[model samples]
Target: MVERCKACGFCVEFCPTKVLALSSAFNSKGYHPPHVVNPEKCSGCDLCGMYCPDFAIYGYKLETGQAHVATAASAVHRAQRGPGNQSTGVEDEG
Candidate 1:
């Protein structure tokens, strides 16, 4: 699959693994789309796709018997545990 992301940023904000982020550039919808900043530490938890409002994010199972982010890794995943998605960089001031 091509990982047809809409760049809505919903998944980036709700990721539990803090692996997703909004691209500095905009998508076709004029929105800064979400992309994986890191892969080595991704853990392939698929939390991004779970809470995505537009289903823009998803997990891809690679041939190596491992699931991986479909795109090139790009943001630093700042893992935090709090009352909300803020723990995952989804909220700036949560």
Candidate 2:
């Protein structure tokens, strides 16, 4: 998804854990995409994906009992509903 990033820095600037930083390397689109800076600190909150206008980045947590990995598409979908309902973007399957 680095190729989809447009160097807006929203992912880097808005990450709650500061897990992302703008990379010096350029993408094919000539924009600097964000890279993970501190993976251990990442909460997999997907805030970066929520903030990305280009749908470029996302994060997901893995739990012992979880059946499926949370998807970035869900995070992006939730973001469209506005800011008040933010969650971990993990939907439980019944």
Candidate 3:
């Protein structure tokens, strides 16, 4: 989805972890899309996805020993359900 980006820099600018940076490589549309600079630093906050107008990027937290990628939406849903409500479709390996 990097090609779908419009070089708006919103994602890069708003990223709290500074995981993304504008790459020198251009997309098919001749726009400089973002690239992950420090993936380990990413907290999977999904702020990039929330700020992205093109929906080009999003973040997910990977639970240890789980096959599923917990997305931002699911995280929020889990939070709303409060503690002890681990009924998400993605199973926890622990």
- Candidate 1 C-alpha lDDT tens digits along 37-86: 65444655667767666655565544534445543223323332323423
Model 1 misplaced regions, further than 4 Å: 1-8, 60-65, 71-94
How many angstroms is residue 88 displaced in model 3 relative to the true structure, after the best TM-score fit?
27
Model 2: clashing residue pairs?
A: none
For model 3, the local distance difference test gives 0.58
- Cα lDDT listed for each candidate: 0.51, 0.56, 0.58
TM-score winner between candidates 1 and 3: 3
Kindly list the per-residue Cα lDDT of model 2 for residues 1-94, writing each as its tens digit.
6567788888778877786677787778788766655554566677776788987776665453111112222221222233454432334221
Q: How many Å off is the CA of 54 in candidate 3? A: 0.3
Clashes of each: 4, 0, 0
CA error at residue 12 for candidate 3, angstroms: 0.7
User: Residue 69 error for model 2, in Å?
Assistant: 12
Clashes counted in candidate 3 amount to 0
